[model samples]
Target: MQKSKSFAKYADAEAFRAAMEDDVRRGRYHDPHQESRLFADVAVEWLHGKLDLKASTRSRYERELRVYVNPKWGAVPLRAITRNGIQQWVEGLTTGDYPAELPDGRSPRPLRPRSIRNIVKVVMGGVLEYAHDQRWIVENPIEKVTTPRSWIRTTTRCI
Candidate 1:
């Protein structure tokens, strides 16, 4: 058996080791250095690999990745994506100081909670779906990360 690697300034070594053991024993943890890929990478891979989404979906993910996920928590590995990060990312997108610049040279409007929630939905959905396919995770992380569902419905204005 190969030895498990450790990170400096990284907490929860034992827990990670345990999860790794589960991965290995369960036949899920391939690629010895899975630790190198961050949630951002996983998100991109998930978006492309797992989703049969449209261009709009891809664009939205690109925007969110560039604006929010990449800047804030891109360096953090997938194993380290806790509910706290998800919560903070959602808050940052909606109520917090998190907006990316637009082509018009202005910061895009901040995402509403619902919109952010949907993004979270897509992201987590993709993550867990992939996890399921890989047999690494049996449950979605949504239960762990509490998110507010957007109650906004349709609105139309036409001349």
Candidate 2:
């Protein structure tokens, strides 16, 4: 058998090595260097590869990407994001500085839960879904982040 490549992480060298052993044994070993594509790059690939979307829908998704997703996560690597970090970022979008401006010239207000949910689903969710399909990350972190809950109606009789 060929010698396994050696690499060093700042910490967790043994754990990382163990993980690599499993990957090698399974023929799933990926070069750590090539796996470092930034989220921004993945997002671009996703946008361009989405041949099924209507022009208007694609435009809307692109706008959402620029307005909501890119500013915060564009420079981050696909694997660097964590569930807790994503949750905190979503929470931040729920209040204070990131408020949406009213079209009627009123004071800016925090994004509505539905809007936040849509942003998460459409922009962040789409990019991560693409990344997951491409195997850039072992699993999509988007699945682990919680978006603000929106109201759902259940069928019931009213008096």
User: TM-score per candidate, in order?
Assistant: 0.60, 0.72
Residue 5 displacement (Å), model 2:
3.3
RMSD per model, one decimal: 7.5, 5.8
* Best model per TM-score: 2
Q: What is the overall TM-score of model 2 with all chains considered together? A: 0.72
lDDT by residue (1-159, candidate 1, tens digit) is 356666674667777888979988987665635644666666667767745778887787777667655666666765566667677766667665664545667664667766666667665556645754654444455556656666868889897
lDDT, residue 104, candidate 1? 63
Model 1 off-target regions past 4 Å?
1-32, 99-110, 128-142, 152-159
